[model samples]
Target: MSTAPETATHFRPVPVGLLRGRRPAVPGPAVPAGTGVEVRHPTRLNAMALDPSKIVGTAAADDGEPRGSGHPAGELFVVCDLFRTARVEIVPGSDEVTTTGHCSRPVLARHAASVMRELLGITDGLLVHTEGVDLPPHVGLGSSSATMASVAVAINELYGRPVEARRLIRFLVDNHGEEIDGRSDSLMPVQCIGGSAAAGLIPGSVQVVAGNAVPLLSAGLPADYRIVLAMPADPTEWDAQQSLQEEARHFDDFLRTGRRHAPDIAYRLIHQAWPALLEGEVREFGKLVFDYRFRMGSIKNCSFSHPRLLEFADAIEPAFTNGAADVLGLSSVGPLFFAVTRTEQKVTELFRDAGLRTFAARPWSEGYSVVKSW
Candidate 1:
């Protein structure tokens, strides 16, 4: 019904050692009478953690067989702020992904309204309104993707449409997967939604999900811990699909060659990352994440990192041997680096005093879910 706020300033970064709870609910406009449904509890998107089985499913294109980790990746997760997930809801087995779903959540209602006011091509005076806590702005994480998938499911249910996973992924990909210079929003949600989200660069399959592993949960961390990110340089801009294609080629080659197999590693790590994160072996998880990103980058003759960022990564690697830190990488990409460490005030202060910013992330197994409809 109305435009989303111009900026997402309501979200606040966590304090160095605390799981900074989300900001107080910054309320938005009330849903106008019969305007549209509302969705809630969205999260940022996560990087794809590949599964070898899902990667090589028969449903995939025959161009070449994909390699899966036998399991999948991109499972363990966290949330910043999620306000709405909406739009299309195709019937299951209806094969509507390519045709039925809506892209651009947090903005859809406004888009619907604009169509009513200006386009007038097929208007019945339907106004879709979206409002909620502004999400954390970008650094490459999957905020928009989560928002879309959640809203798609919610609104689809509201309209009595049931979406199949495969089609839903495709719809999100089609609208969002554009060139950086063009219109795509990284289509980050495609893969973020399914076991392996829609990878525009890499081919995907809709057959039964591949892999034979189950995600395990833990009661709690051995001790309190915190995640710290180090931004060494400014973030960079690049085309996602092109980069993904290049990464996929390397992975394809790895599947082809038993020698130094990256595809297999990516697949294995996808499943492994879940337990590792649950068990709090987050330090190794970080390095594994870095290694995975690097190996994929090597396929394209690009390092998986910014030079300065790598330095920071190395600076923390030794801690792994001593069990000082777990997990590492640019929080989003290129310049920002992250490490998981037991909740030590000193560790937090280390990043803070060094003039780097940091925040806290809890283990989030919950991805995006539909909280309500109608």
Candidate 2:
């Protein structure tokens, strides 16, 4: 059993510049309209399943009503320093959107077209090009969300900054069905707002309500903390064969029979883990993160469906036990597992020794920003 702190000596004051209750103003491009706009959106790690019930309910109806039942549940996430870049430009032609580079997925092209028609009401053809980090898709890095966010921000910029970040977030969340393929969590508000560099720690927990990402707690990790990621180069057969509809069915199964742990998960996130993060208690936060992963009903089912993921989790368990890392867990339904540590190189080497591909990323402090406009 643990007791609350008796004194203020142990915790640092929240950084004044890091407070983030309100939405940050979206920055505008200096370049004139119709110029090519490029924006970078950061990737994220779903640190814990705050509410498994909300995962399937993220899709909105044609009338913009959220499609699921139950009270909205929050999620714990970390914005990784990795980013996907998107550039959008208007072209002379009929009303269609085409994508090039790593973002050639038809779903993304359709999303761009929808955003354009819905927001600016332009019918002109547009070109969207994206550059991705060296990681593959569907490995739990939030790559698709980042790419879509980048494209959405670029489209907004290309049309003279008509949408604010919050409205843009709602639009994206409302139309997620057009982009997402399988059953997965809703488009996190963090994916659209990006991490605020000025917010220091970023929003450690958030709940998606009516397509808005409502921040529950905002805090940062200790200055010395780092995250090391290891992703298996190949996905399991179950992961590979899973279609959007199949994934949705999985969510349905969880809602029906697997959500018994939601209460425990919520308590840990709200009362335990969140406070630990605020006080810069990395080890405590990490322990909660590690435990929270298994507490997620969907992720527990995933461990059985994708047993290879468990093998990877097993391979890295010694690092936490030995204290080389402070935090350890899978990122989303993953081929990717992350260890939070002060010893980045050591943990990264451990993953490599286990025959996994690895990278080290800091907690990104800033959200998406316009990188170039011309």
Candidate 3:
């Protein structure tokens, strides 16, 4: 459970190519027929749980209808080392697209085909395969976003990289509707751009401006720090539509009754947590994040819905207070808890003893990679 050997902080410029921009007039060079591409995209952990009220510039449009691409408020997230792989092969003369593995549903396959047809004007049959960690869906790991982004990246590559990662993200967000119900705010941009690691903005924060993820800080977390994830073995099956409805209610409630702790949460993030992370003060940063969660009344209410989850959280709270873990909090909606800890083994064991599935991951700064192409 001791700290791992210090690794050099990986720093690189955020890929401007992924920033919002107009699509190219002409596409990149076309690949040979039957071209194939495989991409590895990282999933993310919400360092600070999302609170709808805090989201800026993302209310109903002038027409009183929700915008197609919602703007996400400033939020911090870490791209974990866990990955989902997407392999796509273009099969000429075939009339249909087929998908297998993680997102193998017929509806999902049709969705993939629709994306390809719209983006690249390709009607060729696509043989798509995706795989990732055994984590349950809707556990705040950004699984759906990762899968969609990976497939999009692979398709883009097969077509000779004509589309920028940012445009792909924008397209995904704008087009997200009944096809995919549970979409994470800003997760597509993070995954498409290879996350904060690939963007070279580890331990930093981002806000979605006009559907683009703009980095608020470029600092990196201490390389030795680890993220310990505990996913419940039998998590409550969260319906995407139902969850969205709940969030909508929370947003409406926030608009009707403003959050009194908004300013405090913002101050802590911008002043305390940001500085702590910049100075490589892991414990201080973690404490600030853990504290930030409580300030958001919406998140607290959501957490209370799952009694067992609350019980588990109560059991693990002592680790953070006792200095064994730096940060301890839930990720997104529910049923998954993470700790920023030096003693990952101890934290992992604690979660497992509590009857949860546990795994320890390091913060990954780099984005997805095209591991293979043909």
Candidate 4:
């Protein structure tokens, strides 16, 4: 079949990381008087599911550390995709958790710490993670979200500021300085907003555009179908992320203004195209899929990509008889590409044959959580 690495679960790594062994669950930190305790939530690929290329921000949430003349107590935990999370230990004073693994854990941890510092309005002090998510790195998945969401769940518990799932997600949306540290909606919102009875009725369609980095995946995609996230083993860099922001400015205006820019308007139209796919409008939908991929192709990032995005389109462009692939896009600066194909067996075979790694997962519920609070 394939000659990829044997170590390559070549499948899902985030959740698998934890299966090998279990570390002691960490507890909440001690707090001072009158400080509001903070609790954290679980992590997911919420944003990526909507528009893989759009969810890139370099900010952390307020969960990892103490903040805003508030409570000193905080806690952290691992959420799902479920796996090897580094020993989640907290460094008080500074609000940040470290998720060290085989890949960019330490580096990501340090970056996450910085984001947490900013989000919580931390002035000088910093938070450090002695513990981390014990998982393989570089595989396309939401590891950063795991750490950040875990921190959020922990902080929420510590502060005693227990918010409803909607409220919790909204809090992150409003105050999230960046989506870089697992702030994407795929993690938490998928539970409340996905197949669950959270985001009202599932909309007719949910199309996320990578027009610019970090627009609104949950806001765009409808809740009808379960999410399928497929990632590879690479990521994007800082400069590319910035470029997405620039591209986003115009697209954001289009959404607000009800305007269209031919090429730019293509992906948005793809949103309109999805319902037709669900309703078995395969051929009609293929036209739109072609357009959407073309629109996204204008943008580029090193880590994440459609790889043979165009090639796939070419192969499947004419095969619209059986509810063909309705939508396909990259997960933010990714090598992690995703597609909503009607035929799983057929599509999976195609992907595997293409030498692309694949994983079979639906949207995860229970966004970032506090597994252990002492």
Instruction: Write one digit per residue (lDDT tens) for candidate 2, span 114-151.
Output: 54444564566777788878665667775655566677
lDDT tens digits by residue: candidate 1, 268-314: 55566546655655554555655554444421222343434444555
Q: What is the TM-score of each candidate against the true structure?
A: 0.50, 0.74, 0.75, 0.46
Model 4 has a clash total of 70
Q: Which residue segments of model 4 deviate by more than 4 Å? A: 1-104, 110-146, 162-290, 295-309, 312-322
215: Cα error in model 1, Å: 9.6
What tens-digit string does per-residue lDDT give for candidate 3 at 1-374? Answer: 21111110111112111222223333523444347888887767766533334332332222442233333444456667787877888777785667755553334334544555555755667888888887656677756556666776677777776766554555544333222234322221111222322222223322212214434445556777788898777776654444444444344444322256556756766677767776778776676567765444434545533547666766777768888788777765556888877888888888888877888788666667879888
Q: Model 3: which residue pairs collide? A: 194-367, 197-365, 197-366, 198-365, 198-366, 198-367
Candidates sorted on TM-score, descending? 3, 2, 1, 4
TM-score of 4: 0.46
**Cand. 2 TM to true fold:** 0.74
